[model samples]
Target: MSTSIATSHTATPHKGLPPGPKGTWIGGNLSQIGPRRVDFFLMLAQTYGPIASFRAGRWRLFLVSDPELIQQVLVTDARSYIKHFGARTFKPVLGNGLVTSEGDFWLTQRRLLQPAFLKTQVLSYAPVMAELTEAMLAKWVPGTSVDIAFEFSALTSAIALKTLFGLDDHGDRVRVDESLRLTFELLTHRLDSLFQVPLVFPTPANLRLKRAIADVNAVIDGFIAQKQAAPPGNDLLSTMIAAQREDGTQMTAQQLRDEAMTLYLAGHETTALTLTWSWYLLSQHPDVEQKLVAEWQRVLGGRAARASDLSALTYTAAVINEAMRLYPPVYVIGREATTDLELGGYRVKKGYTILMSQWVNHRDPKYFPEPERFLPERWLDGLASRLPKFAYYPFGGGQRLCIGVHFALMEAAIVLATVGQQFKFTLAPDAVIDIMPQITMPPKYGMPATLTRR
Candidate 1:
């Protein structure tokens, strides 16, 4: 269904509430910030204090950085909003996937798929995670530099495709890469086309997106058909297929396709981004790196890291959190109001697409002392809990909280430990790092780091 557009803009002429920087009628302050979305948020925070408002393509976005304000929107009246165009724009590619769907459909799919990512189920995937890391490590030669971001991307791809879909070790790596490359292209092309026509048109970029969607859909279809023809199995595919509501109503094929596709995208994509920047942080802070390695030595002791090891690795976990504060994978969570609501003394009328940006909230100097510096020890000082839940949201908040929160954390810690115990990496000098904003934020320069066995 074509998404309903009620007001198409935050056109309300409200009287009371904090002031925001002025804007043009059509694009608002959107043009002030560069195309890099994160940079834009940072600029807005500098100009209009932590809480501000702006317009983007007819959407009235309240760009919030205050943890208290973030909590009001994400938790208090959360049901009043659902994923706005930012996320709903993904529906064409993701269908009713847990990340894209809304209403009862989203809630139901989330309930069914919830168990697959629970702590125990996630722990069950640890050995496979370890094996995959070692396999990727075997391909690496010591004292050689590699784009660690790309390597982690490929590694997570292998891990996700294997554990989630039960693909073979010698499976079609070429096909998977083709799909990933194309799907990412499609996602970005559409984002750039925000003011243009719908992307399903005959434009070159649109056609490329179409082709990429087909490439990925074909693989997903094949996987599901094979599973349907056989008996139930243990991988995420079978788990999603076999899942039933309390009333025993199983997900239909389309629903299965949606949920499976969601898992395929999320199983490792977000975690890979986290680990990629994490290694960068570790390289910049040698003391943190030394501490993490020491923790790995003391706890893992040349063995595979498990979910259980996460608690004891304070500095290591802090490094991950610190990296996320700088480079959050999901930089922003958007919402469209279903009712005329009053938020923080402001009239948030029906259809205003509010934006709660983690990129802004996390870097606010008030919450994070010297937000730019890499200080992992600050995290251990009960800093995370001292802040409100919505204050430092990397997984977001409320009903729409990321289902893969634990899954991503578990995967990251294990992979960090595995790689830390085995190798150390340093960034190549003068490497031009950039940010390519998409469904998730990723490093643009392809983080290259020289690696050697410790």
Candidate 2:
């Protein structure tokens, strides 16, 4: 049975703005979207049609859920759009990195960095990924309770440190991890708050954010200086350090820092959340866990998963796909229009921000029957090929698609299989798991579970 959702980009006859929930005179829909943005965006799509309009402060925003509209915004008319103000909020930390830069500069940097993340290049890191994961498992003992979220975060962070910087020193990894946590938490706070405080104001929060950023920059700078002094290795930092532009000019120190920070943060955080959520879902669905382990046993047979083995681990990949379907790490992505446009028969003026949410689109019943159920088997067939392009985008779409898509998938699969073969988690009775939609969605209270040796 084909589960693909039929969608069309043929615009309806020009109408006024799409319907949406009304908001107060001063704040618009900012208050309504407080904290629970993922749920709020889903509600907007459910209550209104695909293209829903609202206001946040001075910004006119549209929550576009229809697959065709999403395609138009992300791919067809992508040139007419750029990342929204929300993404720019992290520029303090990300600098002019790929995630924060735009236009020609972003294109150049992307081109310079693209070859480093090629599938063939990424596959070489498989051994490092599995080794780091095995090292993590070596520390775990059955019947020991752990904060599963933190455990995975640490493991992925370590893997990222090794792959990105060629740093195996435990001390450097801890420093980077702590500073990143503080910086992101502060940045997320700034993003969620309606009122803005200038970073130069020396306010308590601004001061804290500044210090956190400084700490992260200092660590990155140290790594760069070390990389510059040493012989070039195969790590991402070394690649970026040696990357040159078309004019034969190498990336300046600042550019290297920006790109390194962007890759470092982007590389680990999302994959960690993927593993975290995968474990949570598998814990809740034992039958699915059993099947996943069975596949691993038949294929891996007491060995760590390799990049070549990824193709044969059908059930393992399905579990990851299903996990992402239910709880996408980057649940929502927004773009601001560069010119006036029409979408879903509504006029979208210049400067309007459009949000395309995976949380909403991934749950659309047209594409996913019984959308809330954790069903990995749904992806075992040719469902991905059958689905419309933007209907199930987890990493996103368009020219600006995540460069680390293959790397993240490979790391997630290797880590999932290696860890799953050794142990399974049982959620603690008192554990409270809820989504906290920050830059990436993580459990609000953290996932507490007991490790049960498989």
Candidate 3:
């Protein structure tokens, strides 16, 4: 049903909470959400209004689909909220990292790490991103189908490891890649299962998670120790190692591990999924693909893309932006209310969860015209300035905005420019590209596509 019709019947102005779809007594909406929680969020927004409320388990969950309300949650009144419970689950793999840490410690960590992601610092890694994409392209064979999602996963992981940790050897790549895969799988299992055993119980799944976390921690710990002994390099690890507190001390060993794990996880998966969806979208829209390829050809002239060439590759960047809008890598961003407050005209009690799904907001017809259509040209104009601030938050917004935003965008643009002109990928026959939104919205069965040399 149209949102206007649904809201007319569902809008709760005052003396009550915002309206949401019906739920059961025990599970509430939890049982109905299933694996594709994105669908449930969309249903909530469409069937209710910009502000929708529901219950998940015992907690009251609020989905803020309006851009204005999102701004309050992410920026204006951000001090009143902390990271939500769902995000805390990542603590097992990420430790007290920036992604999982909060309050004063998180602020301190952000200050220490912010310089490493400065525009100048991120630009230095452009050649590394381009070089790795070139290496990946070299391994592909024409007319053979491959799981592009897996390929991008490995490609981005290698780049993250090499540029951030200064680990370039095949063995290092393999070791880190395996550990990350296992960690992600364990997290996915925990997220998908309704009932989860405690990690201390020594269940098979718990043991596997422990092993994966150990493997990753060992790799990071070794990097820290090595960096401490050697002369510092320009890599992120070295930068962090060189940073000191007010009392002239570097981060503690555990702090180092936490930050390293956080960056490693955040840096790779989002970019990989962004490119994966870009390829899928380009495959489906040959016209847009042709436009992107034409832009690459005109901009690079058969040469590999350099960081300087990024500004000229406008259409290529738009393709990536449009793809991300349709399938945001970090689909849902959640925060918990610290005190009782009013949001979008609804009374929200203390401790209520606030959810902002880019997948829902990015597709809102109010902000983005023809929300279902892939129109990169829409971004080529002044549309960005015309839209509300939080309407297109793929990298999130406010002080907590992704520190790696510039890095991921540059990496994606460079990869597209480097690979777009040399190859064309088409979806394999009968291969369905479905989204499985776990940590990031990865393709459910992997993106099986036929790669053709251009």
Ranking by lDDT: 2, 3, 1
Instruction: Report lDDT (Cα) of residue 323, candidate 3.
Output: 93
lDDT of residue 405 for candidate 3: 92
Candidate 3, 1-454: lDDT as tens digits:
2223122213454668788877888777888788899999998898888888888777789988877778877887788899887887778878899888888889988988888789998999988888888988999999998999888888898899888878774665568667877788788768656577889899988998999888888887876777778877878888887789877888887888899888987889899999999998888889888887777778899878988998888888788889999999999999998887677667667889999999998888877778989999989996778888888999999989999998999999888778887888889999987887777888888999898899
lDDT of every model, 2 decimals: 0.77, 0.87, 0.84
**Best model per TM-score:** 2
Global lDDT for candidate 2?
0.87
Which portions of model 1 miss their true places by more than 4 Å?
1-18, 169-174, 245-249
Better of 2 and 3 by lDDT: 2
Which lDDT value does model 1 have at 52? Answer: 66
TM-score of 3: 0.94
lDDT per residue for candidate 1 within 308-345, as digits (tens), equals 77788877788889988888998988888899876554
Clashes of each: 0, 0, 0
Question: Which regions of candidate 3 are displaced past 4 Å?
Answer: 1-15, 192-195
lDDT value for model 1: 0.77
Candidate 1 collision pairs: none
- Cα error of candidate 2 at position 175, Å: 2.5
lDDT measured at residue 37 in model 1 versus the true structure, 0 to 100: 78
In model 2, what lDDT does residue 29 have?
Answer: 86
For model 2, residues 1-454, the per-residue Cα lDDT tens digits are: 1222234446553556778899988788888998878888888888887778898877889888888878888988899998898998889999999998999999998888888789998998999999989999998999999998889888888888888788774676678778877777788888777788999899999999899888889988987888889899988788888877889999988989999889888889999999999999998999999899889989999899999999999999999999999999999899999888877667778898999999999999989999999999999888999998988999998998899999999999999999998998999999988988777898999999999888
